[model samples]
Target: MQKEIKAIIDGWRNYFQGSSSVGLTLAQERAVICSTCEYAKYGKHAAILPDAQIGNIQGYYCGVCKCPLSTAVRSSGYECPKNKW
Candidate 1:
């Protein structure tokens, strides 16, 4: 829980600092890790909105912490909860 909060805060801080995201290669690497993670859930059904079809539903997310994997992976300072990245 604390980690999630810290990640969010850091994300916001980075955003305001004008350098929030990582390079494409690093982000892609993180994506690959998140995609294969057991705790990473794909699709909207995993988020409990079975009827909705959000664009990011196709992206992966951490099932345990409920953080959006796409956004999380793009943030260089963010770390995986399970250390998969």
Candidate 2:
């Protein structure tokens, strides 16, 4: 049990050390609109609604509301202009 715990700790330390690369979820990378739900207000769905990919946008869904959210709205950083379509 001690060895297992030590191994886990070492793995975490390595991850943080930047010796290896770590992937980020849409929520963590700021690539997706919604990190909790699936409701995309501007489009049929926010980019990367299901799976989060590096170099690609991610979508978040609201577990409570079951709706997709825009990162801009969630973060309150910036509001992208609505698409004409």
Candidate 3:
């Protein structure tokens, strides 16, 4: 719970500071890790409903920490609860 709050705060800080949270290469690397993780869920199982207006991005979600993979990977300060990334 504390970690989640910290991650959210850091994300907001990065946004307000106009800072790049994570590089594309690093984010991709993290994505790879997430793809093979047992705790990862995709499509509807990820609990991310499609938003037709936004092109219906099917994002991944973590079963453990319950954070969206897209947001988690992009947050430089975010550490995987299981220390996978």
Q: Judged by TM-score, which candidate is best?
A: 3
Q: What TM-score does candidate 3 get on C-alpha atoms?
A: 0.64
Ranking by lDDT: 3, 1, 2
- Look at candidate 3 and tell me the lDDT of residue 69: 65
Local accuracy of candidate 2 as per-residue lDDT tens digits, 37-62:
23333344444433323223234333
- Put down candidate 1 lDDT per residue, 1-85, tens digits, no spaces: 7766777666545434544467656666666677667887775544442212223333556797676665566566677778877
* Candidate rank order under TM-score: 3, 1, 2
TM-scores, all models, native as reference = 0.60, 0.24, 0.64
**Lowest summed lDDT window (length 10), candidate 1:** 49-58
Clashes of each: 0, 16, 0
TM-score of 1: 0.60
Model 1 regions more than 4 Å off: 1-6, 9-20, 45-57
Model 1: lDDT to the true structure: 0.59
lDDT, candidate 3, residue 79?
A: 90
Best by lDDT: 3
Where in model 2 is the C-alpha error above 4 Å?
Answer: 20-85
lDDT of residue 7 for candidate 2? 39
